[model samples]
Target: MITDDLIVKMTEFNAGDPKRIQHFIKVYEFAHVIGAKEGLDENTLRILDIASVMHDIGIRPSEEKYGRCDGKLQEREGPAYAREMLAMFSDVTETEIDRVCFLIAHHHTYENVEGLDYRILLEADFLVNAMEDELKKDAIITFRDKVFRTKTGLHLINTMFGLCSI
Candidate 1:
């Protein structure tokens, strides 16, 4: 479980850019709303929130090292950092840590979503990304056809953002 202290620390870690921290918070909020609608277990929802916060932790490093910030690089650099950052939480089991780490590691790729929790986290991230990218008037259609698959996630996307058609 991510404590308030842990969140504070993480948000403060990257003082140079608050947008990254805020982005994670938005993703975490979105994940929480959809996770509840999906009826995820308490433990799983906690993991999802933690994963949501850590998902973009890789961007800064990727920018510094490779000049390119993207999903693959995020996946590549996220896990170990998540582990290091999450070490403060004594309640988090090894399995929880690993699962959350895996989610963060692959949050951007979206190839294999094993459960609703993961799928919702992906959707939440997409919701934020969509907001950032001027939604193609066709996004709702594309999202319906290609992206918004899970009922809870789709509901959040459409209800909060707008209707993304199917």
Candidate 2:
């Protein structure tokens, strides 16, 4: 229920920006699927759900401040917004908030990914981004090799991109 509330709040936060709203929704769906398929526990899956929805909360701020919302800028500005928005929900624990903020901050960083939630967040965001960005097959393959770890994520990418083995 909190996740549902968060989704509504995030949607409202990005009102009139269908592109961003759709982007986060897609990422949230991908994260939910990947997290479920990867056997994440309920709490972890909830964290992933929250993080995926709030991951791009920095885009508007970054655009207003710098006229662009690059990954680094999103990483830099996202956690504060995430914290503020997450604070509205009394049910969300402090630990959950910290982890969600951590995911928001590093969703773009692929190196030395530590937690399952982090790994799934990267893969889910990439799955949506690859399509949204119209990345070439070679680039998708490169990212697939370098970033994908979960079997479900690999399968989704390979199948989505027509790279899966027969």
Candidate 3:
């Protein structure tokens, strides 16, 4: 039930700067592309995309409070905003909200990718991040087998970044 409107609102809320806003949008786009390739159900795909857009909601406050934006603050501050904003979407249940919030809460950590939905979003975010971080040199061999968890994600990353497939 989560709509594109909700995703936009959360992205705007979480992203204070143009770069941050753009980052979330890119992550969401990556998520959507992967969802199509992975054949995720509509509802599940909505949650994944919404979660991807809202993933860094805590970064703003994290920077303010700790003078740095990092995983601990995301785990600490992200879910609360996700819970509050997600309330507007009637189709989004508490359980779905909690799951999305949980992913946002733990996004920077790689320990929680056991689930396919989360794994897909995580890899999508990493694909975008690796590009943003200019980690292009190792886009293939170094992380060819490491960061990518899906065939679709690997394809997108390799193709878009101009890296030869592994």
Candidate 4:
């Protein structure tokens, strides 16, 4: 129920900005699919769901402050916004909030990914970004080989991009 509530909040937060609303929605779908396929436990799946939606929460703030929102700025600004939004729900515990914030802060960080949730988040975001950015086949392939770890994620990227498996 918190996930649903958070979705509404995020939708409202990004009001008049369909691009961001749709971006988060797409990321959430990919995260859900990749998380399920990767067999995440219930708690982790819940965290992944929340993190996926709130991953870019800082974009607005970053843009407002800096006139541009890059990955590092988003990572820096996202956790506070995520925390504020998460505070609205009593159901989300501190532990959960901490992990969700951590995920948001590191969503764009690629090196030494630890948890399944983190890895899946990266894969899901990359999947959406690759299409949204209209990246070339070679770039997709490079990311697929270098970044994607889960079989489902790799398959989706390869299939979506029409890249033959290496």
Q: lDDT, candidate 1, residue 60?
A: 78
| lDDT, model 1 | 0.77
State the weakest 10-residue window (summed lDDT) of model 2: 157-166
lDDT of 3 by residue, 111-138 (tens): 6466767888778887878878888565
lDDT by candidate, in order shown: 0.77, 0.92, 0.79, 0.93
| Per-residue lDDT of candidate 4, residues 20-96 (tens digit) | 99999999999999999889999999999999999999999999999999999999999999999899898899999
lDDT of 1 by residue, 77-153 (tens): 87888898778777788998999888877777656668776787778888887877768757755755565677777
Model 4 misplaced regions, further than 4 Å = none
Residue-by-residue lDDT tens digits, candidate 2, 1-166: 8878988999998989999899999999999999999999999999999999999998999999999999999999999999999889999999999999999999889999999999999999999999999999989988989999998899888898899532
Show where candidate 1 strays beyond 4 Å: 1-3
Please, what is the TM-score per model?
A: 0.90, 0.97, 0.88, 0.98
Higher lDDT: candidate 2 or 4? 4
Error of 3 at 86 (Å): 0.8
Q: What are the C-alpha RMSDs, in order, of all predicted structures?
A: 1.8, 1.2, 2.0, 0.7
Model 4 CA lDDT for position 75: 98
Candidates sorted by lDDT, descending order? 4, 2, 3, 1
Question: After superposition, which runs of candidate 2 have C-alpha atoms over 4 Å from their true positions?
Answer: none
